[model samples]
Target: MNVLLIGSGGREHALAWKLSRSPLLGQLFIWPGNPGTASLGENIPLPVDDHRAVSDLIHQKGIGMVICGPEAPLADGLMDFLADRHPDLALIGPGRSGARLESSKEFAKEFMLRHGIPTARYRSFGSREAEEAISFARSLGLPAVIKADGLAAGKGVVIAQTREETETEIRAMLEGRFGQASERLVIEEFLSGIEFSVFVLTNGDQYILLPEAKDYKRIGEGDTGPNTGGMGSVSPVPFADAALMDKVRDRIIEPTLRGLKQDGIPYRGFIFFGLIRVQGDPFVIEYNCRMGDPETESVMIRLESDLLQHCLDCHQNELNPGSVRVSSSHAATICLVSGGYPGDFEKGKKIEALPQTQPEEHIFFSGVSSKDGQLVTSGGRVFAVSCLGQDQLAALDQANRLADLIQFEGKYFRRDIGFDLK
Candidate 1:
């Protein structure tokens, strides 16, 4: 088993390329990994808030399963500091109170209004409630959304549209523009439609859902500007049917895993959800303990199972809804970025040209870094490229033809990735 896999990007290089095609994989680390997870194995640059140097490299490399993959090291508790500095490893994720559903968007909208689930209609305020959060964003009428109850990496959401751009971005996110991750502010209620991504793999109580991406968090191209961290993605989401995934598994993933196991919260890993699709149902537009960058690089290349046996059956709680499989072809992940990305750019730069992929395309890097040996640019969504066709318009035409054979120096992307399923 011996895993580790924390985070560097491109969803930890697509879960270190599906945990290096597990045969119960016996050794694969990553931590500060990049260079497409250094060809799927040993990367560990350490210092993830130095929990005793990640518990002395998990007892000097006898790792035995970790799998985090970001949400700022599972909202900084780092699975309760590696389960109290190494309770025989095996973490996967979710512990800081089930990572406050995703680091508190007002505790995931009051734990989705205390478990009835379906979301949107938020309210959290603080920073001395800026005049009742500007009178609750002028009573939610024009377009409104504001968010930033913590965590701004995915650009702490905005969607303003007016009411003086929602009281000047809620007094500039409770005054600080995301410092202290916007010292409290939620506001929401602009729910319209179309947005997807589901993932699940829980152990808060038997779960396993995966396969249902749909990224493009607007960096321009018809979806207008601002908001990045995902420039493209897609995976069987031609409107997520199956009667809206059985109303998102009985109205929002079975009451968010029965309200995180009736609030005791021993969650195991990956919960994402995000969701949107209005008219046809499903709501929750947030919650992401992990897995959802370019929709995990297009759902880990259509996930043909064996992601280290579903993270060792979610660390032995033995998750099972027929144990994950998913490969109905049609993937597509694009990403590229670096040209004034999410705002401001430039990093190592080099990476001259790249392409000639084809074994159903792949790439995966993300903000690169190898230097002297080549591959440069280091962060603002750098390379994803995934392809695999036979549908989603031939995987968005072979993922924009391998994202135009990769160039570097300010190489933005999104040649209309999955243009809302054409």
Candidate 2:
């Protein structure tokens, strides 16, 4: 079957790698793909924002399926457009109505609250309602989380430890530091605990849960500094035991699917839950309508199932959890982010020697390009070096070892990517 993959990031690279391995695949095409995907499939230069062009290409190529890898296009109703043009073509991603879980933080929080899903207490506010927001923050006390209501490319949320910091964050978000994304804010009580990412392939009724993963979001080592898209991640998270997975499905995932179904938004693709294990109980932090970045690198590394078949099953509403397969082993990924990431950072800097990996190890490129026939930095999180192992420690060791070989000016990566498992 002919397939079209979207987005340009490490996650898309990993997805391309996996999809290319499918024996059922005839031709694979990537839209605005990066250097990595260029090696695997036809990299089309069509404008990703133009849904009409994308639909035209899909029809021209007889594309059997279109997999969206990022939230932007999904949030902008790309799936809806595709469905409108060619309802028979399988589109693996949520439509705009179903994407509200990620596109609007306030809507997600309110939905969770209404449906009895476990989550942090939050209050939403517009920029003009400063006094009301301040009062809500004061009631929630210090050490609150201030989050921009719209997507801010993963830098919208700020953990404020004091009243001064909380007020400053509120001011910055309301003052347009995050552009129009911060026109509204959601202030919530801080929930301190270990966090994990859970991915589910859903057809709005039936769902198949993939292995859990833990991502390091902080840009600095030892879990300090600002949050980036993702610094690193480890898959088959040991913390998510069978009991915890059951609780997640019963108390969170199932309810969420049911809620969306009742709300007239029947989702039909990946559903990513940002979860926190607070006091031994799981609580959702946020939701991503699609796959998580570095986390996808780790998860895909440990997947023993055929990704193409699984996605087809989801599209057909025939997802059989029994047919799904995943590795019992663990996998870890370390992200090499650009210097000054999660803030202002320079791009187009020449990247030196990259690590040589055996077939056993996976190197997914993110924020990189072949400029003048030489690899150069292009995004915040540049590369995700991933390795599979029997355990988390071994995986971490392999991931770090691979990361050490890649050299470039202004390259910064967290030294403790999966240390939380230790």
Candidate 3:
């Protein structure tokens, strides 16, 4: 069937790449896609924010499914608009009510507390309550998790390790560190644990688990410094054995699905459980209405099933657990970014030294534009080089080596992508 994929990032590139290989796929169209996606499908320039225009094109092109790859569009009620216009259409993201889980940190916190989902204790404060928020932050002590209540790309969160840092972050957020996104803030207690992600495709009640992954968010090595979109990721997480997964499924995943249903919110799309394992127990860190970026790049590589078929099953409310498949091998993704990324940086740099990847290695584009017949950097992150191997060490080793081969001016990447696992 003809499919329309929204967004232009590494996550979308990974999805498009996997979807292109499906035998069930017909015409695949990526809206405002990057160069990598262009090689796999027709890249259409559509005004996604203009919901009517997008829906009109979907009808014009007879697209059977619409897959949203990012959180912004989903938070903007894109799915609600399309579902309203085309009730029978397959939409791969949730509507506005469901999107609040990611769009508004306050809403998610309330939902978790109300539904008895395992999560950190948090309190929300409006812009006027900066002092009140600061007082709450002190109560949580140092290493407080301060989050912008609204969408701020993937960089809305701050884990302040010091009291000064905590107060500064809270004040900055209240005073508009992220514009309107930070007008309201959610101050959460810092949970000490190793963080990971769990992905699933669901029709509210029934669901199929995808590969779990862990992404390095900090721009610097050793997980220091500020968070960028994502520096790198590893899939089929080594620590996510059967015991922990069972706790995650029962304590977090099942409760989440039940809560959504009890709230009477209709959902049919990817639900990314940003979780942390604390002393062998699983606790939710956040919920993303869509898949995580660098994580998606690695997770998609481990999905052995036909991507299109699984999505269709969810849309048709026929998700069969028997049809789901995941690779036993490890997968790794190294996100090559502009040198001064997570900060001011120049774009339009020439990219060269492109390598002919082996069967296990692949490069997925994130942010680049074709200028004067050359691929140039257009955004902070440039490309995601991924590799599959028998173990985490081999997968990350191969991915790191390939990451070095693809060169660009001001290119930067972390060599210790999956090192934490080791």
> Candidate 3, which segments miss by more than 4 Å at Cα?
none
Residue 146 lDDT in candidate 1 = 83
What's the lDDT for residue 1 in model 2? 94
lDDT-wise, the better of 1 and 3 is: 3
TM-score: model 2 vs. ground truth: 0.97
Candidate 1, residue 78: the lDDT equals 72
RMSD of each: 20.0, 1.3, 1.2
**Better-scoring candidate (TM-score), 1 or 3:** 3
Instruction: Report the C-alpha lDDT of model 3 over 111-176, residue by residue, as the tens digit.
Output: 999999999999999989989999999987888889999988877888888989988999998899
Tens-digit lDDT string for candidate 2 (79-149): 99899889799889999988989999999999999889999998999989877887899899878888999
TM-score, per-candidate, Cα-based: 0.33, 0.97, 0.98
Relative to the true structure, how large is the alpha-carbon lDDT of every model?
0.83, 0.89, 0.91
lDDT of 1: 0.83
Which pairs clash (backbone N, Cα, C closer than 3 Å) in model 1?
A: none
User: lDDT, candidate 3, residue 153?
Assistant: 80
lDDT of 3 at 363: 94
Candidate that would win on lDDT = 3
Q: RMSD to the native, candidate 3?
A: 1.2
